[model samples]
Every structure is written in structure tokens, then in C-alpha cells.
Target: MVGLRVLTCGFAAAALSVAGCSATGTTGTTPSGRQATTSNPAPGSPSTASPADLARKQASAAYVGMWRDVAEAAKTSDWRSPILSRHATGDALSVISRSMYADHRNGLVAKGAPKTYPKAISADPSAGPTTVMISDCGDSTNWLKYRKDTGELADDTPGGRRAITAEVKKAAGGWKVARFAVEAVGSC
Candidate 1:
């Protein structure tokens, strides 16, 4: 039952994150960088993005960007605080929420990430709607801290690895999370 609850909570968190982006009908992005357009329209015309392509880009950017932040946030239990303060409603909230879920799983580990942490997340810009949802599958070195009966702080040196997937969406504010799933890889 406890395991079910944990899984349910994780999925619920993913769903909520996705909903934020879907509800607002927005995509998150700074107006500065220009993304490459897919289909070429005319010789002299500016190439424009199809709704589908735009969605994928939005989700990919949001999801990938969030993953980068997750590692940093794990250092502080309140990683989502900065995201919330930014008023990250739709896609942004989804991304962060999903990341928090993933991070929590890592926190359960005993040992920390390997000294040479392997971190990598992939974004496939070739999938989904007016907002794209990318999958981030990768591994990392993580550390887990716990207290023993001795009343002193003890740390587990498990080099936990992970395979994580995230779905992002486009929101009015920017990109946000649509879904997130993660599985610990190998032995700790």
C-alpha cells in the first residue's frame, strides 16, 4: 500500500504538471533565441513552424531546462520554491513538479552519486501538439544521507543511477512539465 501510494503520488504529480501546460494553452520561452523552423514555405518567405512542431520545441526546451535545474534543487529540499516564486503556472509547474518527484526518488538512495557523476538527458524535438513533450532518459551519480542509531549523521555512498523520462508542454508563460517517469538503474 505504501508503495502504491508512492507510485500514485508520483503519477499524480506528473499529471498535474502536464495539466498546467495543457490548460493555459501556452508555451514557455524567452523571446530572445530563435528556433529553426521545420518546413520551408517559399524561397523568399520566412520559414514558419507548424503548430505541432512548435509544441514539441516548447516541451523539449521546458523539460530539458528543468532537468538541468533538478540536480541543483536536490541540494536543497525546497528546489521547487524558486520555480513557484517565478509564477510558473502551467508548463513550468509541471516540469518542476515532475522533477521534484524524480529527485525524491534519488534522495531515497543511501550513498551519494559517484565521484564522477554521469549526467545526460536527451530531447527528441520530433514529437507531439502545439506543445512538445520530450523524454529525458539518463543516469547520474547520487548520494543519500541518513541517520543511524548512533545519533550521528551517516551517509550512504551508493552510486545510484537513474533512467528518467519527462514530458514538457508550451504555456503562455513558457514551457512546463506534462509528465515525468523515472526508474533507478543498476545496483546502488
Candidate 2:
């Protein structure tokens, strides 16, 4: 049960972080001090987005999407939701599944969605990147677990802001969150 709380709360923080990172369109500095920007082509222009830019955008989207999928599954404690695989893979997927399974067994369900602010911190290879590192300050203030049978809060700990990091890799389908780590509450 303690592990389940950590997983549920931790994932909410991670999701918030990823969403914030991707949605702000803020410029980030890479490990080498290079200025990296995440922006998309205006309208339907010639699509002048660089490979690095595209990778960052896609990776950020996947990270944010993973959180959304997890939130959806958490509502019903459904670990086997097919949507989980759409944006997550590897350990990222495994952790979410395990968390949801535990929630199901314990008769707990999560409500609300997390808010993420994710930024592309780094990309492997300046040109034509295949992996992107994301840093985020996720807020899980409103996302929390509840007892399904009684509709009551399950944990005493309230969610809050936390720091999160994720590695998104290019997969056969598309960019996917390969792994992520969420710190304890107030970590941000």
C-alpha cells in the first residue's frame, strides 16, 4: 500500500511536469549550453521544423500523453488499458501498470489530472536526435487516490509540486516515454 501511494502520487507529479515542459514552448538550454527551443511550424507552412525541434516536440507530447493515459486508467484502476502502451514503453509502462494493478487490488482509484510543465533539457546528437531528456516541475495538487467503495480519500498525504525527469526515445511507432522518475512532494 505504501508503494502504491508512491506510484500513484509520483506518476501524477511526473505527468504534470511533462505537460508543463511541452506546453509552455519555452526555450531550454542543453547540456552543452546550446540554446534549444521547442516550437512548431506556424499554420500549414512548409514545415520548417528542424529534426531536433521535431524530436523535442514529439518527445514532450509523448511524455505528457503518458500521464493522460495513466490518469484515465487510474480512474477505474484498470492496469490493462490499451491506451497505456500508446505513449509509454519499457519501465515507464511497467511502473504505471503495476501501480494500477495494485490500486485495483486495494480498491482504490485516482481522480483528477496532474499538471505538467516539461522542457526538453537535452537531445542526443544535435542533428537528427533519437532521444530526448525532459525536466519538469509537476503539480499533483488536485490528483489523488480515493477508495472506490466509499468514495473517500485513501491516503493522508496531499499531492503537491515535485521534480520529475524523463527519457523519451524514438520507437518503431513513435516517440515514447522510456522511463521517468518522480521526486517526493515539494521537491520542485
Task: Pick the lDDT winner.
Answer: 2
Who wins the TM-score comparison?
2
Superposed on all Cα atoms, the candidates' RMSDs to the truth, in angstroms, are: 12.6, 10.8
C-alpha local distance difference test of each model:
0.39, 0.77
Assess every candidate by TM-score: 0.45, 0.77
User: What is residue 19's positional error in candidate 1, in angstroms?
Assistant: 25
- Output candidate 2 Cα RMSD: 10.8
| Candidate 2: stretches off by over 4 Å | 1-5, 8-46
